[model samples]
Target: MTAKVTLSFTDETIEDARRYAERDGMSLSAWIDQAAREKALRELFNAHADVVRRAGHDRLEKHALDDAREVEMVRSEFRGRRAAQR
Candidate 1:
């Protein structure tokens, strides 16, 4: 069972939402629902990341170094893309 809800937005926001809805081939309500779900998932991931960072890692020297190197490579690639755009 579902209950109906009313939402209000500024004209510009409504236009943007309509555009996004058309792009996704969904009704504005469906598009908003999908966007909300994605946002919730991202927030959950961010919360998990904080917990993982606090715990720290216990690992062998070689394995730890390899993991760090992989992370560095990804960071550098992301930075390079950002730098190119600027």
Candidate 2:
């Protein structure tokens, strides 16, 4: 079930969205709906992630700062390896 809502956009933003819709071979309304849905989904996921992190903070044993740095180092190393292989 869907309810219709009216939204107002600045002229420039509207024009940009219309151009993007044309480029993607979609109607302006369809493109806007798709973008809106994706943004809403992302926000919902982020909210859920925050809630989960808060709930498990004490149960999680790893140090947050060290874990983040390690993850970044691993990601950088992996990227370098991949680039070298490529």
Candidate 3:
């Protein structure tokens, strides 16, 4: 299911996002949605890392780095597709 909602942002931010969306060959909504999803995933990963640290895992930092790499891989894949289209 999909729902539409209104959002407001500073003019500078709106312009920046529009430029990024255009550069990525995506709609503004899609660019914002991908950013929001990445933010949510990062938050969840941080919370999990904290829990692991509390559980006496000394590799929490490494796990966080791995998570970051995963996100970057996804972004690279999207960019690759856009490049291929050109």
Candidate 4:
């Protein structure tokens, strides 16, 4: 599903986004949407990392990526279970 939204951006920001969209071979809307999605995913990942760290399972250098992946997988399963119940 796609939505048409009205958003306001400054001239400089618009120009920068246009340049990036052209460089990436995407429409302006698509570029903006992709950027927004990436930012959201980054925040979600960071939130998960904070939870893991607070739980005293913060990653060691050798397995940092693996630990993050495991956390993500576990979180995904938990989300799935909740969805099923609802």
Candidate 5:
């Protein structure tokens, strides 16, 4: 469901926005809607950017630990092989 919104803008601004809307092959209302949606998304992302960063950091740390464990396991296997060949 969508509600109609009425906004007032300077004539010059409205003209510029109309031109942009035509250039993008969209209606003026659609252009404004997209702009507002994008602005809202940006604000939401900014608000949780730190939380996102921390989640990413935690994932990288887990991957690093898992990789280290795998490498050590391979090294141990090779050491055992060398011992058997001795």
Candidate 6:
């Protein structure tokens, strides 16, 4: 289902969009619709990520952090061993 809505744009912008639509072989409405849908989906995913980040750190987050710490420790140990061998 779809509905038609009127929108206003500057003459220059309208011309630009019209040319873009033509180059892509689509109607102006279709071009705008695709752009709007892509932007909407991106915003929706970012919002979901924000909610997850705010929901409180849990076991999964802690485990990832712990893994990173272990990796750093191993790298530091290797550096120390290399320095000793030099």
Q: Which candidate number maximizes lDDT?
A: 3
**lDDT for predicted candidate 2 compared with the true structure:** 0.69
Candidate with better lDDT, 3 vs 4: 3
Residue 29 lDDT in candidate 3: 82
Clashes of 4: 0
Where in model 5 is the C-alpha error above 4 Å? 50-86
What digit string (tens of lDDT, one per residue) describes model 1 on residues 1-86? 34579989899998999998887667777667666655775686567566656667433434644677756765675555435433
* Residue lDDT tens for model 2, 1-86: 45688999999999999999888777787678767765775686567557758888744534543477756865675455435433
Question: Which is superior by lDDT, 4 or 5?
Answer: 4
* TM-score for each model: 0.61, 0.59, 0.70, 0.71, 0.55, 0.56
Weakest lDDT window of 10 consecutive positions for candidate 2: 77-86
Q: Number of the top candidate by TM-score?
A: 4
lDDT of 5: 0.68
For model 5, what is the alpha-carbon lDDT of residue 37?
A: 62
C-alpha lDDT of all candidate models, in order: 0.66, 0.69, 0.77, 0.74, 0.68, 0.68
Give model 4's TM-score versus the native structure.
Answer: 0.71
lDDT of 4: 0.74
Q: What would the C-alpha RMSD of candidate 4 be, to one decimal place?
A: 8.3
lDDT of 1 at 72: 78
Query: Which is the winner by lDDT between candidate 2 and candidate 4?
Result: 4
Stretches off by above 4 angstroms in model 3 are: 60-86
Order of the predicted models by TM-score, top scorer first? 4, 3, 1, 2, 6, 5
Residue clash pairs of candidate 1: none
Which pairs of residues collide in candidate 3?
none
By summed lDDT, the worst window of 10 consecutive residues in model 3 runs over: 77-86
Clashing pairs in 2: none
RMSD of each: 10.8, 10.7, 4.5, 8.3, 20.6, 17.8
- Considering lDDT, which of the candidate structures 1 and 4 is the better prediction for this target? 4
